[model samples]
Target: MTTNSIALFFMTDFSIPKPNHNKALKTLAPPSLAGKGAGGLGFSPLIALAAILLNLAPTPAIATTVKIDRWSTTSDRVTLKVKVLNNNRIPILGLEEQAFRVKTKDKFGNPHTLQSPEIRVLSPEESHPQQTYVAILLDMSGSMKQKDTARVKKLDGAVNAIRGFINLVKAENLPVDISIIPFGEGCNHSYQVTTKTIEDNFKSASNSELEKQLDELAKVPVCAATNIYQPLTETVKYLRNRFPPSPSEIDAQDKPLPKLSVILLSDGFHVYRNNEPQQFENVINLLKQNSQITVHTLGYGESLAHLRNRAICFKYIPDDRLTVDDVANGCRLPGSDIQEFIVDEDRLKKIAQTTGGIHEFPEDAEAVAKSLKTFFTTLREYEIIYQQPGSDRATIHPTKIEINSPDRGINTLQSETENIRMSNFIYRALTFTQRLPLLILTVFIGLVGVLPFIQWSKKLKQQSDL
Candidate 1:
């Protein structure tokens, strides 16, 4: 087909550049587009039309492009990246099926596809089609100084678990983006210390550097006040900006919004001022109202019990505390006879349940490692694609996402998904008062409706006076 005719299908009011035109079309077309003698100046109209039709024909339907990311932990949880490409190495978008299938050998050595019903689909785009953001929030409070054993510290436990989680995510071999945010008295607002750096520096850093940072985390003394709201608010703000409202607000379809998954870690109570609860509630309620982000909280110590209980009151946690003995172990240092090292595991569990996150208290290095492994593995298995009805700027649209799996002897799972479906809602920038024309019309209508009744009442009063 002529380049002009080919351009019609691919371009809208905004046109693709001439240089990239061929590449874009090739990425979308079937193999027939590459056939010999398909393009020529002297070809008959009929021949040209036939060639064009053949090129436009869809490819044989098989499996859809499903983006997959894997994450794990070493000393803490690590965010994993997974990108799915076609044979031409171009990123695929909105695949027919976006679920992750694990191929493992059973005892007989036969490969089986472990069909995990949970799958998440990302928005479609030519470049960076698969965008994923996983946030690991580590709690670095004084309670983390507790001792697990004579030789190892509780901080050591936290580091080991986080490190192991990171290692697992790296093994997944997907085009994934990762971020790490560590919180204690308050989240490290400094750019150098926050997880936002992961978008740029995480993948490039050597394993040694990653370990160095984790080691230094212990030496950094915990601040006195444990303001969980600050970090939580910061995390929500970052994700909202990162994801934006929708395609229209974003200005271009080529830029797909990143899927946000927050993993929070804390070992202290949320000491917000009396007014702070309302502010925290507003922020969280705004996030829940949007249906675009999923938050998972991990509580680490006995101090966290209060925070966990309060967090659960809001139904934000799915499970209880993700405590590591190393945090308690760190408190029992030599010559420091501190008997109260173990954190309240029950409280931690409640926090996890409220936030819909996994709660576990790992006693040693091995258990910590295994817990990290499970957490990452579950993340890799579950998948979701956000489907809001209108523009991201619409702000108040109800979002509904349907997860489907045909092979696992399941026909439908929508209802079950809804009850456990995490809130991804956000508030629109414009409030009801700002859209005042409608408000004015309603006021006018109310006045009109009440004016006749007032007039009738006045006439009756005058008649009675007569």
Candidate 2:
């Protein structure tokens, strides 16, 4: 048929969602003569049909809301804190191992499928099965002496806040070994809280004694300056010593090594003496090097903007070493010799981010306690253990993780795909040597069954001959 005839037929037959198709034709046609009606202007219905078809066509699937609360890789396994939300944005509970699949890709986009990854849904009420080691690092700079509107000193409020954290941990029955580290000027080993000190105090002390110890910790005199860097190195070293070199080491040693988490309370200032820039570099490097250590920074007493701006400089120092040139470039204004006094939030955030931890700046001491308590509640997260197949452990790999409802077929709403880069890459080879015991057991069982069958057959044949 001719194009004009087809257009005419479509225009006459098609219906439009309006006063009428004739009115739609009038609207589509440009007004040249006011007297002209809908019949004179030619309008085609094919355009509307094409538009409907375009709208109806399938589009790319949207990712459901999901939060990767924390993730870390080790010599033998990758651990993740994943929270999947449904369409209503609530955390979905009771996910099994079969609900998740992990895909690790090298820099070149080569996919490495893990043998089996474990997934456990965390319950906010219950404590995690693994033992936990926590070191609470309290900043004792002079500014911490300032009181809020409630007439309570900052230091006192912080101590009270931490007391609540300890109480919550105890209530949850989390097997936690706690340490309180106080940092400031001119305080050598005199006022520092070490893991040994906490363990020693708790070993013989009752609950009331523990409270007394906390009071003693809170009473540490505030110093003129803050030395966040040195304390961090100490805390990380202490926590790392608690963890085994590999996950398998925990099994081999037959001891429960606790997971390490550091809760640092600071006024969001890094005012260390002597090479302040280098101190920042050291802290950042320490966190990056120890990926297993989770550092949560709680900043109070300053505007978050001030805290966040100071933190941006940390992005420049990817490694431990900080040259004058690096500082001049990172911390100073472009083409200006004058250096800007920066806040410490950015670096603090980077430390938390790299270690799969979190940073928060609460408004008050009460808020601080509440946030810490909330954090402790979410500590019970699922663990996924998968066998690594690839040999390349040096390069960073991009990982895409998927979670689903295992038995709910076809219509199940998948969790949002998590795209993250894997750090602290450790390669574990899956070799036949590890399976020797199983092989031996299987062979021995087979031989025993065969020998019994042969004996029975011989006895039956002898009976028949008789």
Candidate 3:
């Protein structure tokens, strides 16, 4: 199809909501557009790149939604991560086990049920001295020095807003550890993957340490280049070191395996100074290798967005005029090559989608702050565990997940596909503390059930021998 025809097809066939640009979108609707069908669409002769990126649209604004991240099953236990968002796209936390009415189906399309449901506030990932590790990668590139309409340096705005978000996290009183990395100060030109630290360090400090470190962000000098790849690599490396890569290892060594997430706030573009782009691919590999780390991205301004357009446009701009904004933004008129920039929502979205995280484009610092608060609140999640007999393996997956809305209605959330691998579990892996009650039950069964059967069988054998 011609460029105009393709653009018209996408415009009519899908309903990907435009970014608020003025405000961060509130509700992250489940991506069920194709399932429900499309609305009327109209388009003029435009470009083809716009049509393709149309599918990459972030979660639409719809009713409440739920995403089942993954199902990790060991022989003895099952850990599930379900993310539920309200109509406003805000996360819904504090739901008790009763609220999670789960239905099950097997891979064979047969009836399946999870026996002996053990709902615990304590799991490998949450509760019982809960710990959550959050890392904030802030962009302090030279472009950050540019002032907004309010004459606020983008860096200062982000700093002040993040400071407020930290206070909000403090109020939750949950065990949340936060680390701030301000990258790209002078290192951009020097070709070093460096940061101008708030506390002059690249440490993931928690509690009061965050306040001291954040104060240094505004005063730190800005740099001319950015290596988005380095900070992403460092964040993943830190978390991987702190926690084992698999659920089995986590359950064996840790009492409560903490939740891991990273927030990348930037206003410029990604610099390839040397091999940053290639390194970015490696970083993506680490994330995909069962790290279970969610990378939430916030595009702070228009610069990054512009760069994203250019990247998309580069593929289709008339060969005669290769430099232009993305087609979706109507960069049909060619100009100089688009700059390498951040706020590249496309790149940010890819990272977030890889780890089942959220991505937002906030226009200014205040909007950025609001987005940060949403991040803090959404980190609080409900972890559910299901168990079954040691000798049997049952296909267990959540079919229907629903919750009673505060507004006097029941909101039903959809479930995604999951993988469950059963193990040859001869005995349940119970902790020493859990074994006591179970020990008593074993003795009771022996005396009342197994012991009698054994004695009768022995008596019969003796009679036959005589």
* Worst 10-residue lDDT window, candidate 2: 2-11
Model 3: per-residue Cα lDDT over 227-344, one tens digit each = 6777777667767776766643245653446778888887755656356457657777878985578888887776433433334332333433322133334332244323423356
The list of candidate 2 runs beyond 4 A from truth reads 1-128, 149-151, 187-190, 193-208, 218-224, 247-251, 254-256, 304-343, 383-401, 404-466
The best candidate by TM-score is 3
Query: Which runs in model 3 stand beyond 4 Å of their true positions?
Result: 1-81, 85-90, 93-99, 104-129, 185-206, 273-279, 303-342, 383-466
Give the TM-scores of the predictions, in the order they appear: 0.43, 0.52, 0.58
Task: Give the per-residue lDDT of model 1 (tens digit) for 1-466.
Answer: 3211111132122345334222321224455554445254343567756777766664422222233332211111111234433222222234334443333232233433333243233332212223456666676655566654334555677677777777665665434555556665443432233336534434421245666677777577553445566666677677677566552222245343555666665544454446754765665565565445655554443343322332212122223433322233322324542323334454445434444445655544455555565455334332333222222321222122333444422233221111111123334445677879888988999999999999999999999999
Question: What are the lDDT scores of the predictions, listed in order?
Answer: 0.45, 0.57, 0.59
Comparing 1 and 3 on TM-score, the stronger one: 3
**Deviation of model 1 at 62, angstroms:** 29
Residue by residue across 1-466, what tens digits does model 2's lDDT show?
2111111111223555333212221223356654544454343366556766766664422225445544555654555555554332223445555666666765576787442333343343332456667777877776676664355677888889888877876776666667666666654423455656544533211256557767886776665466677777777876677563443223344453456778888874565446776877777787787776778877666443322233334343533344334443454333432122222556666666667566776656787776676456445655555543342454555554566553432134433444443334555655798778888999999999999999999999999999
Give Cα distance to truth, residue 409, candidate 2, Å. Answer: 19
Off by over 4 Å in 1: 1-129, 148-152, 186-208, 219-225, 247-251, 273-280, 302-366, 381-412, 415-466
**Tell me, what's the RMSD of every candidate?**
25.5, 18.4, 13.9
